[model samples]
Target: MSRFTIPVCHVDDIDHESSKGFEIGDLNFFAVKRDGIITLFQNNCPHLGVNLEFQQDQFLDADNFYIMCSTHGALFQPEDGKCVYGPCQGQSLISVDFEVIEQQIHIAEAATAIA
Candidate 1:
């Protein structure tokens, strides 16, 4: 598959680097890191299909370890992209592949897995 490299942001700019919102090609992406591992998820919540980053850092929980869906109060773990609470309990957030190079997050590949 032809993967497009979409730039997100600088590492230093992110407070937690794990749970943060990113934008690329008019689309928003979310990232989370736990135990030194990083995972990316689309900003939209599955239940309402609404972008979770709409409010000021609402995507992040008080601990800043998981991505929370502000629309329905869904809690998602960034480790495996699983939603542990809310309407989409059994569903998972869509994963967005990315790589950090030179301290910048880039969309390493488009979500070809979806198709």
Candidate 2:
């Protein structure tokens, strides 16, 4: 098993109250920044296991209050990825643990290097 720390982007890259998706190697993820807090989550919807974006970097709801699922219209909280409304109510998005070093978000991952 090998562990790696990958830098995703600068905090300023992700606009406040918005989200942007990124592909780190083979994994897909998205980041949401609200009120100076950054939250990262895998691009998997809890209900149908679908990507949670209507379009590019457009993960928030119409009012930009919650994370919305493109397919089913599910809404999730930005801080903790909790599904506040829609089909997957009470369920939550899978959160990716990350660190902010000098204003850059870096995610730590463990993967088996392919031989």
Question: Highest lDDT among the candidates is held by which one?
Answer: 2
User: Considering every candidate listed, which one attains the maximal TM-score?
Assistant: 2
Candidate 2: the clashing residue pairs are: none
| Residues forming the 10-long window of minimal summed lDDT in candidate 2 | 106-115
Clashing pairs in 1: 18-32, 18-33
lDDT (Cα, tens digit) per residue for candidate 1, span 1-115: 3254656777655555446766655556766766666677777788988888646545777777667887778988778778898999989988887778777777764452342
lDDT of each residue in 48-86, candidate 2, tens digit only:
998889899989998888999999898899999999899
Segments of candidate 2 deviating more than 4 angstroms:
1-4, 111-115
Worst 10 residues of 1 by lDDT: 106-115
Q: Rate the local accuracy (lDDT) of all candidates.
A: 0.71, 0.84
